[model samples]
Target: MRLPLGLTAAAILFVLTMVGGAILDQLNENMHVRYRDASVALERLEHASERISGLLREAVLDRNVLLTVGYDNLNRTLDTTLNNLEGLAESFGLSREVNLLGLRRLELQDIERRCLKLMDEDRWGEARDLLFGEDFALSRKLYEIDTENLVSVLDDRLRREATRFATARQASLGVRGLALILLLTSGVLFSRRLTRELAEQKRLQRELTAARDELEDRVRERTRELEHANRQLASLSYMDGLTQVANRRRFDVAYPQEWDRAVRHGYPLALLMVDVDQFKAFNDHYGHQAGDQCLQAVARVLRDSARRSGDIVARYGGEEFAVVLPGLDTRAAVAVAEAMRWAVESMRREHCVSDCADVVTISIGVATRQPKPHQEPAELLAEADKALYRAKSAGRNRVMVWSGEDVSFYI
Candidate 1:
């Protein structure tokens, strides 16, 4: 069943308190075990040191013996004592305390050295006298010190373990009391709080779901509106306003794709740039409004003349237009240029500045090339512009094609 947060927290607190009590109890038991083990190790060390000291005392009392015999027995006893002390220190993890034990062991070592020195000098009586006298006394004193240190370590360990046990016991009691309080509080408040919170949560969940659904619907409507707006913007971006044909922006976008395709398929692509002759003079004679009408008419003719599906006709700017045709060679491009020139001439608009006749004629430049790697769009336009200049130089109302090899002026 569902429950309020406060009640849930109280129950969780109760469970955590019980778990913590169990952990603390286990820790206290481990501390007791360690204390017991340390005490046992200390007792063993004390007994071993006492036994070794008793042997040294017995050897010293027998002063009539040769120095070699006493030295050998004492050396063996010292070795055995050192091994036992090291083993005990390791088992108890008492490396720092072992340093003190090491100092005591050094006293036994000094006694052995003195015995060897007496033997080297061939002074057996003096060596026996030293062993029975100061050396034996030092050995007994070191043994007493070792026993005292072990007792002190054991006492300290016991105190620490006792303190730890007491602290854990107190903590366990406190935690148990808190757990009982938490459990009781949870039990008392569970029924009414659980019922109220569950109802509130359900109400909030329903409200949130309704709000989410409303937001989704609004988003869908906004998405549809944006899609329609994007289509209108795309159309306006690519189409000329006056002529309803492709604009220069659209031509620029399509030209690169066509050029790449031509190169891939080893086909020819052609460009035609057309300009109206004496258009400024015509505008000056008639007016800006009539000049616009003439431009619209020319735009219609260019659009209609682009019969191939791959042809693009665009209003480049005032009094200028461009056409792109794919899969067309130079000869075919020249024919298309001528057709466009004649179409513009057919309009028969009068212009007094015309050198050939009193007619509005278009000068056309055609450039055709099989697309190649590293060819740029500006190269094609430059060729077409050069050809257009040639057509104008040869008298307006004519078409010219760029020969890839020579820059000769042509008509």
Candidate 2:
């Protein structure tokens, strides 16, 4: 009679174990479905965000109107995804993150509107500026940070849920070991699936990180290229196109800065106003191209003769060049002028139409002054001009120095 009772108890226990194991299996299936759904939704959100970023970046640099359409569709998709995301966030107790995402979405919409308006108006420069502006950069950075944070929070919660699921599986295993032996196989399969999915998730995260890094490197390279181009443009702006020397604008800027330094240091600043002898006649005799060549040759000579790094050689205007010699006295300045004059005479480039020599020549006027605090740089320039007049009046190929109010020929 006892053996029969023991057998009946064992049977009851086995039936109870089977029922409990089935319930646990159902719960695990429900949990797995929710996890899968959340993973799919998060992936959709990531794709949409990445698409929006790429489309907007491309739109800023390119004038393709089609990108606008592409992004607009993505925006609609993003709205739907965000709604789903918000529901999930709320379920996961991430209401604050949801609010932040909503705010960022509105900001992104405003940016898009402004960008689209600029595109419609054909204001690509302004659009580029707006997109690359500090505010826009900051906005994008904040949005990305918020997104990463949301992803991290969701991943953390999911990991906790997975841990709970694992614990429940272990408990089910212990309670129903004899009756639900088949569940061991199911548990092993589920574990393998979870491991594979986690690995895939990690791979996706790594890819996203790599992509972001590549984009940043590209941005940096582009910025460097733009900076180099700007520098080239700025340098070109100050150079004479014909002679490949400093233009009048550069002279104008350097002259005052040098003058201020001279005034402060109590050193003499010298100016040489040089003009090609009979340049107009030379242009008429030799075509304009030859005339330009003549000017370039003279400019090259003047640049070479300056010698000192502090000296400046500039194309002051038509057929005229100016040289600034800082810390040079009148005598030293006259010596430089004479050297330049002698070099051109030695070159002996044939100039049959000249009244001076049979070769091309230049007339130089040298003026040096220890500038006073109250004096203007123009005063020195005028003195140099007067000396230049004296050089031209005296002879075609000579240097004249300004002596107070008078001009003296430099020997």
Candidate 3:
């Protein structure tokens, strides 16, 4: 009776193990399908948004009447994409984000209608302004934020599901182990059957291990891809679209971090506020396109001249640049400022309508501080600005250093 009972228990446990393994495998497969689907939907939405923006730009700026067809097609594609995205978001329990995206879509449509009306009136400037204005940018930014939040929520749920799958796998393993112990105890009475069962169990175990390994590999690969995408998004957020360099947002973030580090380490930190001399006149005489090219050239020079690993070059605003030099005293900082000024002048980009010189020139204001725990980063920035003003007042195309009491020309 005991032998038969043990054999029966072993058989039942084996069956349970197999069922649990099958269920876990199915769950993992379903997770993979959902992950892939959500990723595809996001990529499609991003592509559609980019294409729509391009079409709008062409219609307004280039006055390309033919782009109306492209715009209509993109609108249709975007609608389909958004519908798919909303469905996926709802499925992932992200209904709130879906609603937010819907609201953002409506906002974007209202902005688009006004822009199109302006375009029809041949108010290209107003249309262009509206297309690139704060309202349009805010709407687009909100859309991106909503999508990111949706992805984040979905990712967190998938991680929880993965954990549950791991737990189920462990349960399956324990059931299999118990089955093997029962089979061993009953081997004498049912040696032949036990042998066959053991062999079958070994084969199934091998297959299960292989499946788990493959699933884990897939999950790891997906994680790496998501991480890479996040890194790219962060880079794009910090970079200037026009200059291809660090933007003011990046500058705002870095300054305080560097300042804190300088305060902690008892090291000097330098700030350079640089401006293009007579940039407005240059823009009026040479046109905005030329002005853009000139700024790009100047940015390139500033980026190149600040060769230290700790130096940060950023487009502070239109025709203005800022450089953060870590561990540089007033003397070293002034030298770097002078080098930057010379490099821009050497570019010799023609700015004929300037009172300063025949070619484009930059005025730089240098300020260095051994930051204290009580001091703010803005103090250094303000000093640099004052030095920059004095440089411009004295004459353009020179570097000035702030001495706390007065600003003096560096060269």
Candidate 4:
């Protein structure tokens, strides 16, 4: 009777183990299929974006096609991609991305039309400008952002799948252990140690549960940290790495917002275009590393000088920097520019190669315009830039204002 009971227990445990393994295998297969499908969809969308961009470049920049063939092909391919994305969105619950892509495709079509017309006219420069304009660049940026978001979403899903897989594995293992205990009980029902063994099994089960819970809690905490890191990384995109100030991208964003606000309030918007005097000579003299340090120091001075809540100092490309002074007239703006110039000069960073001054100095052009209807804020920036040129041409280390006057001398 004991032998028969032992055989029966072994048979039941073997069957349960096989069934658990089959279930786990099936779950794993389903998870893999879903992950692969999502990955493939994202890759296809990327392929579409790259292909369209390439065709647009070839048609516009190279003028490889004299006709509208490229445009036709681009439209067809984008339509197909849109259709595919619609299916994927329904299956993957990506409706938001699909809507955004639709809008992007519409904008791309308009841009392509304008570019192809220019190419047809044999005006290559205009074609290139239209193709590479802010609109086109913005569309590409949006697509890139969307692609990253899609990839992130897919990665999150994959992580969730991994967690589910692990949970399933733990549940199967627990069930197998319980089955084994049942088998042992059947074969050793009359043993005096049965109760003690069961008590030990209960303790082991408690430990396993605790370990799983702890592991899950740790994963949650790590996920939160990863999320915070991602946000910080995004913010860094708009920051100048060396000087720790706003970069050109941040400047672009701020410019439009401030311009609109000033326009609404009918206030004068002032812009200061600041240039480090003989910066290239300074770089040639001291090497790029020192040049970077000089830039950082100058940025600090500019930032300190314009500490108003509305003042924005951003590193415009290379050694150039810009300060936007909203609500200030040309005179007040000029005063701020003079302060910035003196602050930088006081740093006395040696620039023996500079023809302007032996110490580091800055040239500034201040322009102020009352925001008017149907007028662009860029006009103001252009005036400030022209004034900056005049400052440099006259002599470096001075503040000049562009007030619709001849800028032959420093004011």
User: Candidate 2 overall Cα lDDT vs. reference?
Assistant: 0.80
What is the C-alpha lDDT profile of model 1 across 129-150, one tens digit per residue?
7666866677757766766777
Whole-structure CA lDDT of model 1 = 0.72
- As a whole number from 0 to 100, the lDDT of residue 2 in candidate 3 is 54
The parts of candidate 2 lying over 4 Å away from their true place are: 1-186
lDDT of 2 by residue, 273-329 (tens): 999999999999899999999999999999999968889999987899999999999
Best by lDDT: 3
Per-residue alpha-carbon lDDT of model 4 for 1-411, expressed as tens digits? 445565466547646765876787687767666666666656666656665665666445335564346557656766776676676566557678777767876777788778777777788898899888898999878877877887787677668777887788788767666655666666555344445645775897799699879978986997798678657855775677778888776898899899999989988899999999999988998999999999999999999988889889898878999999989987788788888888899888898998888899999988888988789878988998999998998888898888786643355
How far residue 73's Cα lies from its native spot in candidate 4, in Å, is: 32
TM-score of each: 0.46, 0.56, 0.61, 0.61
Clashing residue pairs for model 2: none
- Give the lDDT of residue 163 in candidate 2: 81
Model 3 lDDT at residue 174: 90
- Candidates arranged by TM-score, highest first: 4, 3, 2, 1
Q: Write down the RMSD of all candidates, one decimal each.
A: 39.8, 15.4, 8.4, 9.3
Stretches of model 4 off by over 4 angstroms after superposition:
1-7, 10-205, 405-411
- Listed per model in order, the count of residue pairs whose N, CA or C atoms clash below 3 Å is 0, 0, 0, 0
Query: Which scores greater on TM-score, model 2 or model 4?
Result: 4
Residue 328 in model 1: shift from native, Å?
A: 0.6
- Worst window of 10 by summed lDDT in candidate 1: 58-67
